[model samples]
Target: MLDIAEELNAWAAEGRDFAVATVVAVSGSAPRRPGAALAVDAVGTAVGSVSGGCVESAVYELCRQALADGRPVLERFDDDEDDDDEDGLGTGLTCGGAIDVLVLPVHAAGPVRPVLAAALAATASGGAVALARIVTGPPALLGGALLVHGDGTRHGGFGGHPELDDTVAAEAAAFLDAGRTGTVEVGGRGARCGSPVTVLIESAVPAPRMIVFGAVDFAAALVRVGKFLGFHVTVCDARPVFTTRARFPEADEVVVDWPHRYLERTATDARTVLCVLTHDPKFDVPLLRLALRLPVAYVGAMGSRRTHLDRLERLREAGVTERRLAGLRSPIGLDLGARTPEETALSIAAEIVAARRGGTGVPLTGAHTPIHHDGPLGVGSPA
Candidate 1:
């Protein structure tokens, strides 16, 4: 939903009516994740995607239906079978996967508008927000919604059951903290078991950070790629003349500070990526010593084999352990034989993606692996 927030907010400001269809759950080899969404405005314009193109036509029709009915809907699409089109409308999944989608009608003047407005505002402000909807519940409760903001305030009300609403809000907060979008099942009494109520929590947190510890041409190239890949890129260097925003306009920020000191003062999480592009011993040694010990998602250093070896020795002497050093990907990027800065940036970006998505960095043509792997919930084991 955050992916389409800017567009949706524009439509909302224009008082345009629209409907949103979000993939709430998936099984088998689904192409998209839980937060994937598609929205259709009254004029028949659509944005975003739920299942690539397989189930889009069907979901778009559902969105139109939702807008007309002025209510929310929970629709499921499954792998195609001989009898899958029994309904005669031909709305069946062609892909070999199953997905559950929540379709909600939204308008400028409606019960759900506040939630949509709040969601857009949260993403715009770079704050965290989550929306929970009853995907599977009693008829009256189905599609009931709640919005939880970063400051513990809530917007739309949930199902009439107070206990269930409280439980869903708490679960949404936990998922927001973990930066996850998934489903949670709760009982009527807000406990773990009873009459099942599946709440689909869609979250929007600030973009993951990519901090490049060098203000060089390679850093500028990497900043452009990082921004294209949806990261909040920052270029930091102690040399003020080299660390100007004019040099790296694509970067979200240009920090004129020592890499290690700036990193110590910044907020980083498990999704943050630290790139040490400064191959010089004076800058690389201490910056890497600090990065290797942190719990960041990826830490890579740009250097030759000899430089990497010397840096490792310096880090070990600075109290970085063998296990900690293992986290570093020195001589960074894949074996792309990249000579230009743009190509090197591409290789580095590819390696970062492969690491995050558990890819092997091998050519798919000769390898045997799932074409579409499991998503956030870890439903299907990777092949």
Candidate 2:
């Protein structure tokens, strides 16, 4: 969706008329999840994809028709023919995958321009907003969604369902706060035609934060790698001399505050990543203390074997429990025998990716430990 929104912004900036096609529901095999999008410019150039290639061309044609006819439409596709797995949708999927898609004519939400503008603004700043589009079975959620947390208060929404408005708004707020994309159950029970409705909660989070708490050369390399990976890199150190903007031009911010104090200020899981390259007890001891307390997605420490052991002892003495200490990825990065600082950054980034994805590729259901060690273990997810 972010990609589509970006392309839309570019198109609108350059004065191109376009429509956005989205996969609103699925009954069986699905190539992409719900809320997947594909932007269709008037002349048939498309960006992003809702289905592999199974339905993109078809969806684009429908978008053109909607643009001409001036009314949103629902379409379906069934590639149940003899198309090999590699030929078309990339699934080589000749077997069978049916899908339900909606082609919405994206004429700015009215005052459509400002409404669309507000949604884009939230996305630009990495804020959260829900787009409640009514596609299947009625004129209920036709207008748009009440985009919360942006330039304006209430944006667009389903016409005339005050109860639904309240319920969906509450769910939308919860999804935005968590920085997640999900579908909530609501609307369709009351007198409004009773169609089981699905509202997609799309989060417009700023680029992820990558905070390196040391000003070493490793920190510089990590900042470069983090930027390549789309993180809003920040290199921080208490030493003004070591931490300079020249070292990391890619970094969104650089602070001369103490490592521990900075963690206290901004250390939530969604917006923060603490990379302790300082490797100094004076630096890492306090930094690690504050990092473990928060629900950060990744907290990695770069150090030698001896340094790792010593740091663990300090954390233990600081009254950090074994369970919490277990989460501390000392000697961070995968066991890829990374020798150089660059290789080490790749290895660490790989582990961080796996952690965020919540798996080590090891089968949790087959193993004896807890599913996540935290979240739900992906039941039949590919290895």
Candidate 3:
């Protein structure tokens, strides 16, 4: 699946035949969302996971069986252990949820192999692509796939009626535009007639942006953490000497322009997170003033308690509204008694993830909150 595209792409390039089991639907408290996959190669080597660990062994065997028979299969695993008699695999998820997985073999001569390979290559290269496959349909149409690109181009087909392909492509394009991965139902023979078919649209978009504004040591550690979180990180500081590739090697880009100036021209979306580490009034005021007003996921600034108060006054004097300032995460990062740069970066990254996933900055051991919050499921998720 697109989640493990890089590793799967490498396997495909090496001419290794494999079978992949991808989660197409999920319900209740499933640990993994849709588009999560587990793949096993001809040599029984495995990569990636569908459930965190609950049903991996069963999914692994399912992949091996798929490779052996060259037939696509759709199986459901749930928390009902008593239902083992229904399926011979007898695997039950203990996560108090259910998932539907589609297993398909990717042999060199398989009709769907090339399309899968193309999708893996595009996704690994950071190109926007969507793979739409039939999760439930007629016998011949099951597991058939179509690859849709960002530019509205498409390759492969479901081998269904022409209208069915057109309808699925259009729906897949719409999902790709929103960077959404889920299911869309359509009639079998085009939009007009026949049995209903469910197509799973898995989208692979470029990672969201994490712009760290400052070139201090904390920024270096934050860059590494941001990259670890699958963000295309950018480090921007007006001081060219401090902003260098050597200092923040993990950052995708190092900008020498003023923080506000660079952000003014950069492409950002609701998913982008802005971290302002420059505590100087000049840089902090201008940057925070702009960042707080932007439609970004997070806007955090690093400063001391005294410095935070002073910066707040300066921003208020700069005409920033109280509502806008309310969004600012001054004195950035959760409280963990952080002393070192790495520890501070961890705190900051934890806060950012907490904000994005709607988590409280509190210990979970004694808390009654759900481990996974009901937050927005980003691209490639079936929420």
Alpha-carbon deviation at 304 in model 2, angstroms: 2.3
Give per-residue CA lDDT, model 1, range 1-383, as digits (tens): 66688888888878899999989888877888888889999989999999888778889989999999888888888876335555654655676779989998887788768777778777766778888877887877777778898778887766467888788889988877777788989996688888988888877888888999999999999998998888888999999989998899878999999889999899987888888999998898888888887888899999999998998999988999999999899899999989999999999998887777777788889788766643332211110
State the displacement of the C-alpha of residue 86, model 2, in Å, after optimal TM-score superposition.
16
Clashing pairs in 2: 85-92, 85-93, 86-92, 108-112, 109-112, 126-205, 126-206, 145-156
Worst 10 residues of 3 by lDDT: 374-383
lDDT of 2 by residue, 300-380 (tens): 898999999999999999988888898788888888778887888888777776676565745456776433222232111
lDDT (CA) per prediction: 0.83, 0.68, 0.89
Clashes of 3: 0
In model 2, where do residues sit more than 4 Å from their true spots? 13-16, 25-32, 51-55, 75-100, 108-114, 139-143, 150-152, 189-193, 361-383
lDDT of 2: 0.68
Give the per-residue lDDT digits (tens) of candidate 3, residues 28-82.
Answer: 8889878999999999999999998878888898999999999999999998764
In angstroms, give how far residue 224 of model 2 lies from its true place. 2.5
Local lDDT at 212 for model 3: 95
